[model samples]
Target: MDNQSLNADILILEGLKVTPRSSIAAFIFLLLMYIFIMVANIGLVVLIFMERSLHQPMYLLFCNMSVNEVFGATIVVPHILRDLFVSDSERYIHYIVCVVQAFCVNLYGGVCHTILMTMTFDRYMAICNPLRYTIIMTNWMVVKLSVAAWAVVFVMVSILLSLTIRLSRCRRFIDNAHCDNASLFKLSCEDVVINHAFGLSYSVLLLGSSTGSVTLTYIKIATVCLRSKTKTINTKALQTCATHFTLYIILMFSAFIIIILHRFPHLSDHRKMVSTVGEVALPALNAVIYGLGVRYCIFWYRSDTK
Candidate 1:
């Protein structure tokens, strides 16, 4: 009994040691980054809600994106900040808490991706089928689509979390700073073949389906733009889609890099840093990129004052 207890304590200490101690400068840098992300994302959400002129579909979707950013960053950054301030002895989080945090973070992040894809489709329809845009993308349809996105996210994340939490973490050390879902699986001593298979299958299905849909929509939109006789309409369509295009590229590339890095464990530290920047820092820049790059946003702002 004494030996078993001592082994358990050792495992717990090993898990605690996974997160490296940060210097004062590193702590301050992380704090500043968190604050910047929070302020920028929250400020965009507020601006969209308050500005009556910005109540269009595009802006509404932007607001949702902003909200998701706030929720997603909060899930990771608060724990990171706390870990920085506290010692390992004081930093033990309950296994249940870790699982819940991982689930929520993935849920919001997935929802954000789905919403952005929907927004891209919405833009495509509006630009390519202007006369039928209203009839097709009705308020009712928008509401239903948004609700369905959330529903899918909830169902997928719930299943993933259920499977993850059932695994016994006998070897408690996690490689990453936070209790990431994949890292948690790595720490588990139980047979995780089922969990790994399901996770990969779901990810592939969801990502492939969504990417295909977004791609088809944009292809049709581009074709329409090419054949259009009206240069003004063509310009407007390009302007409207520019921000969404940039967002899609950023998200898809970042997600791809992260998954690749996670799978290929032998990748160097520089590669991991790139992935982190893609996932975390890129998200923080979304609002600024969209706002500055989209002419419609500027037009709405200027016209509102007049």
Candidate 2:
């Protein structure tokens, strides 16, 4: 058979396995969790947009991150919930749908990494170059950075997906609950050396640059805080950096865990359970972390003024 003939119109998803009784329970739990994720992230986004006082570069970046979290979670969680009720034999997703989901999943990760990288730059300017921060990270500049970040990620994801689409598929069954670029590409019958090489390079470049930026920026930030003899300066600077750094660490940690698990076939049985933390829990924690940070900042500001 020709490679095209072997390509499947409908791909089967060997989604999470659970008994009928547990399926309902899983559905309800996920439904509640999804609801909370939506409310928390959306609430933060709305609050930032509505409040004139919170229109600074830092909060604006937080808003971008929140929106991205919502986008990523919505793409995966709701679909999983729906599939929880689907019988194993009927749990099929169209080829087009799977491809689209894979694209969106890749897009979400790219956008997220880029945004965090931008945020690090913003924080570096604010902490390391306070006087010039207003000039460097203006509202107009934030808009530009945000737009540029999204545009770059879009281009990268498009390139990645295009490469995957060109490959001839030989399989129809995806051994996971959700669609991702790696899983989609694995179906190809032909050699995937190019695909794997490009993907590995893409991930390393994107993730490496982001991690490097965070490290250098934070190091500079720390040096600045230490050199300043003023206790209040040290306190405020550490507070701000702590918030951003915490989020950065959590995000990177979750991503690394997922990557590690995916690399090892032996972990396949436990992958779904662990992957849930990276996919769902991390986003929820992001909103909580930033929200608390905002609240603390407000309180600190009020006290200082008084």
* Number of clashes found in candidate 1: 0
- Predicted candidate 2 versus true structure: per-residue lDDT over 246-270, tens digit per residue: 8888878877777788888777757
RMSD values, in order shown: 3.6, 2.2
lDDT of 2 at 208: 96
Model 1 lDDT, residue 172, Cα: 59
Q: How high is the CA lDDT of each candidate model?
A: 0.71, 0.85
Local accuracy of candidate 1 as per-residue lDDT tens digits, 131-199: 988788876777777787778888998898888877766775545555567766777788899888988
Q: What's the residue-level lDDT of 271 in candidate 1? A: 46
Candidate 1, poorest ten consecutive residues by summed lDDT = 9-18
Task: Report the error of model 1 at residue 284, Å.
Answer: 1.5
Regions of model 2 farther than 4 Å from truth: 1-7
Residue-level lDDT for 145 in candidate 2: 91
